[model samples]
Target chain A: MNDMVKLEKVVKVYGHGATEVQALRGVDLALEAGEFTVVMGPSGSGKTTLLNIIGSLDRPTRGRVLIDGEDTTRLSASSLSRLRLTRIGFVFQAYNLIPVLTAYENAEYVLMLQGRRPDERREKIMGLLRTVGLEGMENRFPRELSGGQQQRVAIARAIASEPELVLADEPTANLDSGTAASLLDLMAQLNEEKGATFLFSTHDPQVMRRARRTIVLHDGEIAADRHGPAGDE
Target chain B: MIVRLAWRSLWRYRRRTSITVSAIAVGTALAVFFVTMADGMYKKLIDEAVRMGAGYVTVEHPDYSRDLSIGLVVTGISSVIDEARRIPGVTGIKVLIQGQAVISTAGGSAGVGIFGIDPETERTVSPLADRIVDGRYLEGADERGVIVGASLAERLKLRPGKKLVLTTNDANGELVNEMLRVTGIFRMGMEEADGFLVQVPLDTARRIFGIGPDAATRVGLVLASPRDQSRVLEDLRRRLAGTEAAVLPWQAVMPDLAGFMAVDKGFNYVFQMIIMVIIGFTILNTILMSVLERTREFATLMAIGTSPLRLRLQVAVESLFLGATGTVLGLLLGGALSWYFQVHGIDFSGIYSDDTTIVGYAIDPLIKNHVTAGAFLLVGAFVLALTLVIGLYPSWRAARISLPDVLRSR
Candidate 1:
């Protein structure tokens, strides 16, 4: 059987012959179980594009992508969407919490999508709110909360379905440094204790410093791969 | 959860939702009012027609139906009457003879349609005997009196005590004239049926026309229920099939009346459709604006496991809820309007609606209103269906939202 995640010589290209932009060129990578990894790059470095392919929101152009030994490239779009719902989660830079929903409801939305019962949902949501240190603010809306609280709510929402993988695309880009640091610490704690594999994209050195491993992408290819507890490169 | 969210969402945008719901409600109320008004006017016309001696169904000789004359009486009249009475909804049966005759006055003379009826039997068939104004109706076997329309009396300059001569061809095709006294001045407001319309005793009419006592030009029937008129007509046909007589309803006997009523009904229907379309577009506008404002919210749900079909169903349910509420409120509003008109009447005496009776029916601007229950249900259903039809497209668009694009935008 294959490992937890595998990308063997994957390529993603845009445009035709003359105007081709190779977003990913012959990339090969593997993530073992319970890994906290960050893909870092400069502008136009294809980090977001790479994250999208692994998150099942986009397709690889010329190679196979697999998760837990199953080929993701062979799955239909609908099935891929189902896989994302059941086995993966996502957080975005804009704190993409639905503005219409309260924080408790926003967190419960994922559990409802997963078809969890009400009592089970109550326990999970309350536990998650306390875990993210936003216990009393569960009833607050996204607009009513501070930036750090909203990110915490987003984190609660991301892990609500208990997925095997979480792909966060520049999650702390809009937050202040203090809020961003706290958010990263919460995510790292979850990763270390719960064995949930996280793959995030960012260019921030603070985020990179906290990551267990950071893969740097330059011009659509891996420039430097670093692995340690904290900045052992 | 979806329903709760949808309902709560409406509350979040209170002004927008209220405006939308008010638009729907006003649309529904307007539709209900017009639909019931048309139906009430039509019912009044039919009720007056039935009350003024013409029953729901009329059986006549196939030959004289084209051009009626007392000289043309069908044989086997007794058997036809017996068979017609056996029909399930038949309340009463009456025989009548009609013909064009010249009534001579001291000054001049003019042609008029003379109606011959059996007075005793006619009392069971029509309530017109109760609406006598000036003098008594044709009462006894010795009575030779005839009732005349008020307009006809005015034109001829004749009074209840005046003497007039009515002349027509006999049933054997010979000319025979009768001298009679103007017994009563009966008035029904109908221009054609009453202005030049006259009614006489059947026995006197038969003797003058040289026709037999047992024959009649037509047999008018009253069905117990107006809605069961066709059923009674069918029964009359089956019973009279062996004889040479043709079974006829009022529609068959009076083609001109049927045609006029059909045109009026068509006009009413067109008006109804126009009103419904207006209501439909109002709902469409409101729902379209609602979906447009919630584009991002809808996209977030789609990004979760809520399928497009589920989202569409959610929208449809919301529409149904709104439509149902509107329909109920509208029905009540319409009922109130109909009742107001039914009691007080619409005073159109100001403009063109003043004193206008279309085609011998009393359709003055202040017409009597009579709303039936069938019309109430149909109008309610119409408004509800219109809301659904108009709401479908906008809801479908709401369901087709793409989350990736929505998330990518600023």
Candidate 2:
């Protein structure tokens, strides 16, 4: 499989002088297309920093990131935004659906930004909503939905454009264990059905257990990389 | 989708948006109403000044304007009048011989400004003909008959048919005297006009002053509309290029009135600009707060693949929507108020006396509104443009928000 995301000796530092803190240190990673991977770490281990650098939402202080064979570190901010729009999708821990938009609109937002036709956006969003078990709840706003349902809508939004790389930062952090399990089941089903790659950062053990490949981050560096029994590469 | 998002986001803070919109609406309404009313009042003052003395456009000896000398008179008067009458905007014309003269009754004598006018033509243009409080207006055949202001006749202790002697110099600088009967009395509502002005028949003045029938000090051209003054002045100047006639507009003849209106209009515009700035600040505060409170949401949008430029565009669109809505509402309200006042004027009789004058032209106590379509559109466009300008800082701030910091904090 082709590599969907590649990070080469990445380092990210916040502030300077006495206030300086390193978020990531010389981390090298590759995520292949169609893989369900999780990067597990405690808070301050730079899980979100890695996700951000890989998503093109933030630039690394050192080294380079490649998404879909394009050098993101060399791209301008506008160009990086275009790369993210076309090649990447993100699911946040808080299920950051636009509150003013309905569930269907939230799912359709990326497609609209891609300048797709209305008919195509509607078809894709409706199918994704059904697949995520949010079919009847399409017209409801994020505030009206429960946390599990909002997270389902967020998952639908992430994969709506069929992006090559999907990044989820602690997707199940805010959900109960049962809801988290079902959400992981939904993500796995989508990964298998749609062949879309996903990289997750989480402290949830269930996510780590379900992950086909798990990379453990400790103190701003990778401690170990493992493949669980469920699916191994 | 951007517009939809902008519109929905505006309603997210319904109370704030409503308050901002209301402030803009009220400011715009007051601006429109006061601007139209002032336009009407100034129009009334200009018309009163021009029609009563020099017409909207005047023709006289080029040197007569500086000296006001009876010796410097416009010759070939019939041809000048005929040529002026052919001009497009020239609605009427009047020939007059104007000079200062001493009028003596049996009891006393006083100096006054005397005008020798074609009584027939003056009836159509001058309000003096219609303001005869007592007695009748002069006739073309009454060569010795004259119209005197009520205040002048009262001061002289005279009545209609009473004889008085006018003493002045003829065109040759020779002292001359003519006896005139008071044919009419007029109350012009201005102290300057009612106390110091007198009009006599044109032939009688020519005979008394020893001037030829073709000689006159001034020929005034009345126009159908005030806007036609400049074009008519230009045409008359071109037509009478070599006649040594100074074709002047009313503003040239009435500098005090012109200056007063200029200062008055300047103050009005400054006042209106202050109102717009206040409205602009209200819009700025609301939009700035909205952007500030939604920092996390904007960062989320950027992280999810929406460009910073697009986020800024959405915020601008929101401001534009707010401005357009308020401007439209204000125009409706202002138009209704203006229309009502245009038809039924606002009475200022309680506020101002009837004889209140701006540079000696009486102001009518009732003021109407006169808003042209162009003026209305200009005000609306100005407000909309100002709103857009005031929105720029907040949009820039929105685009400059740090995505990583905001998302990490959330």
Candidate 3:
């Protein structure tokens, strides 16, 4: 498979002099296209910082970050937004759906930003909702739904645009074990079926177990690189 | 969808918007009433002037209205009448013959100007028919009848069918006496007019003055419109060229009345400005506050790619929405009031029943204010435009809100 994302000696620094702290330091990594990869770390481990750099949500303070063979660290804000819209999809731990919009509308929001036609949105969004088991609950608001149901809606929203890369920041941090497993299973299924790359930042054992590839980081640097049950990596 | 969004936002602030709009409506309504009433009252003054001494236009024995030179008098009424009748827009003409006279009666008599007028034509031109509270107008030119001014008739204690001895100085320097039966009492409601005016037949005036049937002191020409008074005077100057008749406007005949209109117009404009200044600030204050409150929403919209200028335009739209609705409501109410007043004029009967003179025009003290649609629309538009323009500052502040502050706070 093609390499979907590559990072080389990336560093993110905050403040200066006595107040300085480094968030990411000289970390290099790559993941194959259409792979389900999970980065596991304890608190303050820079897993989210790495995920943010790879997802095109944030840029590195030093070194180069490449996605689909183009250097994203150098892109301007507008260009970065365009890249995020066309290529990268983000699923936050909090769901982060607009309070006023319903489940179906929340899923429809990303596609709208991409300027997709309503007809195109209707077909794709309906299919994704069905796939994520939110078929009949499309009109319900996030506040009105169960935590598990809302998470499914968030996952459905993240993949609704058929983006090439999906970055989930602490996807199962707020879900029950059973719901977390089911959500991870759904993401794994989508990653295989659609050739869509999935990368997640999580401390959950179940998520780490389900991931086909795992990267372990400690104190802002890579601690280990490990593979799934059969030792593919 | 943009319009739908704007509409929804407005509905969300219905109470506040309505209050602001109502304020504008009331302001516009008041402005409409004031402007139209001032305009109407001023027009009425001109109409009364037309009804009084000065005809819409005057043709003289050339030097009459000018230096009042008696030598320039027109010699023949027949030719002057024929020439004046052919003048375009000259509605009517009347010959006025006046001379000083004294009378004796039980109530006491005073000197007055005795005018000679054709009874038939006089009925058409003067309001003499309306003023006959106790008697009838002179029957005809040869009826040997006379209409005395109310105050003059009162002074002489003369009643209809009573005979009064009239005396006038003739052209030959002889005093002439004739007996006239009181026919009607003419009332203009003016102190000077009521005290001084008396009407007699043309033949009687000629007989008393010892002049032939032809000569008269002045010729009066009534025109189609009071606005045409000056234009008619100009035409008379050209038409009666080389004649001794002094072509003059009523402004020349009665300079005080013309000065009254000028002063009234100036005061009206000053009052209009003050009203606008006081009310315009109310609209501006409401609109400015509305913009300041919607800062975050504006920032989100701009972050989503709406230009700053378009955001400002949205504020303007909101102002127009408020202004237009209020204006429409005020117009409906104000128009209803104006119509009611027009139908049943307000009466100053109680206050001025004893008689009062206002700026030299004898009128009721209670003046009803009338509103016109044009005035309503103009004031509404003026206020709306003011509110929208003032909204720009707050809109700009909203558009400039930074995204980091909003999302970070989020």
- Give the TM-score, chain B only, in order for the candidates: 0.90, 0.94, 0.78
- Model 1 chain B poorest ten-residue lDDT run: B352-361
How does each model score on lDDT? Answer: 0.75, 0.88, 0.71
**Pairs clashing within candidate 3:** B60-B245, B61-B244, B61-B245, B62-B244, B62-B245, B62-B246
Best prediction by lDDT: 2
Q: Residue B26 in candidate 1 has what lDDT?
A: 66
Q: What's the CA error at residue B113 for candidate 1, in Å?
A: 1.3
In candidate 3, what are the lDDT values of residues A1-233, reduced to their tens digit? 66789999999776799998787889999888988888877877887778777865556889898989999988865566567768877776656554445789778867876788999999999988887778898888777888778878878878888788998878887788877777777777778888899988887777777778888888889898876721344
DockQ of 2: 0.66
- The prediction achieving the highest DockQ against the true structure is 2
Clashing pairs in 1: none
lDDT of 1 by residue, B96-188 (tens): 777778888885787888878878877666655655677777775635677777777888887787878888887777887888777777766
Least well predicted 10-residue stretch by lDDT in candidate 1 chain A: A224-233
Q: Any runs in candidate 3 off by more than 4 Å, and if so which? A: A1-233, B55-118, B121-128, B142-144, B161-181, B201-254, B365-373, B400-403
**Is 1 or 3 the stronger prediction by TM-score?**
1
DockQ of 1: 0.37
| Cα interface RMSD of each candidate | 2.4, 1.1, 5.3
**Candidate 3: Cα lDDT at B348:** 65
Candidate 3 residues B84-108, lDDT tens each?
A: 7877777878887656687656667
